[model samples]
Target: MLGRQQDEHVRLDHAVIGGNDLSEIDDAFDSLGMEPTYAGKLENDINHLSQLGFEDGSYFELTATLEPGQESPWWDVHMQKDAGPTAWAVEVTNIASVVDEIAERGTPVDGPNEFGRERPDGTYFEYELATLGTKEFGTQLPFLIEDHTPRSNRVSTPTPSVADTELVGVGAVVVGLGDLDDGIEVYRQAFDLPEPSRQTDEEFGAELAHFPDTPIVLATPLAAGNWLADRLETFDDGPCAYLLRSSDWDRTTERFSLTGESSWFDDRLAWIDSERLDEINVNLGVLSP
Candidate 1:
């Protein structure tokens, strides 16, 4: 039903990837060929942030804790576990209206809470946040953001190093679930996404469901000892992978020293080895055009 709406209510804002150290996060992504810009510390004083911006304005937000043993409302456990792509955000207009709509759909919605981070330049990046499903933050459901400052001020303009590359922006967020049916229902209730197309990847060892045309894919382990199962054991049900869009499929492959390749529904994608970017521990890849 949401897909039929005339005015778009939601769009991918950024993917939240947590790490133990900011310098390590920057170094890991730099080696991956997409350098991240340091966004400075949060007003809460718990974490420092960086942004890997893309042409579409969406980004991969690398978050690192400042105070060890201090609690971060959403990403404390994720940072502690070194969970890479732990949470995600969607941008929306009329935050109050969107919150009401999602609540009316039988999903619990929390806060248009004010949050901010100070940029290195001493200017502030202010925004409002609302989360869906649970308070834990990595709900496989997204938290919503509406910027008080210009969003351009919050997101780094693309640097020439990555701007010339084929990578576009975040195309899909792969959520690792314990149960496929339960995950599907959670997404359905939160956003009212239509029935998704389902499949299984023997190599990935998971069952997949792709919500049509959206940047959401739900994955559940096919058996014990699989990667998804291991991720769930530590990180629970939340984003496990983030695939960026590419303008040219072939150029994307040749541009980076890729670890392996795979398909997301019909689209082709290639990933960088996690070992290569061990500092960040992120499962990052690029999707073909």
Candidate 2:
């Protein structure tokens, strides 16, 4: 399952990177000119995820667990084993239906559970998710988001800093795993993503996956060898890739310098200045402290 894709597939709806290095993450933000919108917390049975706000509803989550006392899905495993991509959450219209569809194929799933961000009014925006698929699919299965909440009224408003804040979000995510080709096939049959081009490197391994639209791209290494490889090997086949955005690298990088530790990277993708990005627009919302 670690080779070129045979069919075409669509883009990823989003991507999530999980790591335990919060301080390093903060330091990475300092390198950027702006600051990260410190999203509070998302508590589940297994992981503790923190959201960072951006101009649009789009944001990247920082995840880890309190402790590995129990069998957990995210942080505990990541800390004990190794860091790697561990879930390919699909965007779906109906969580239950999607779960049923994948489960019929014998994939294990978790929620039509209500998940989302809390709006200023104290109302929460939510979406349903499916379970991770079976061992053959590498368990990259995750719930799809039918409703995506905009971070502000000016979600589309351009930022003065860039003068042209063109790039919206993660363009591609490169993942390193065991059965790259098999996972690619699962994405194709499930999401209808375009077939992908192939290549390989000794250190990185084989890659077979498609680039989703603006916002999220997914790539998987053919062989699971390094630290990243081990995570994919354990997390049951999810995200272990880096993100791509249609942004001016230099200007964005400069923001990293301006902001400080509010931003960070997981050796992949920039946690762009979300607070700064939203600052460009005239309208702002004040939620409770």
By TM-score, who's the top model here? Answer: 1
- Residue lDDT tens for model 2, 62-164: 4454443444554455434424233333344455666676556554555556657553346565555444545422225443555545424212222322234
* Candidate 2: C-alpha lDDT: 0.41
The runs of at least 3 residues in candidate 1 whose Cα sits more than 4 Å from the true structure, single-residue gaps closed, are 1-7, 67-70
Clashes of 1: 0
TM-score of candidate 2 on Cα atoms, chains taken together: 0.60
Count of backbone clashes, every candidate in sequence: 0, 52
- List ranges where model 2 is wrong by over 4 Å: 1-13, 21-24, 43-48, 53-57, 66-75, 79-88, 96-110, 115-123, 135-139, 148-167, 201-204, 211-236, 249-289
Error of 2 at 271 (Å): 14
Query: Candidate 1, TM-score vs. the true structure?
Result: 0.92
Identify the leading candidate in terms of lDDT. 1
With candidate 2 superimposed using the best TM-score fit, by how many Å does residue 103's alpha carbon deviate from the native?
5.2
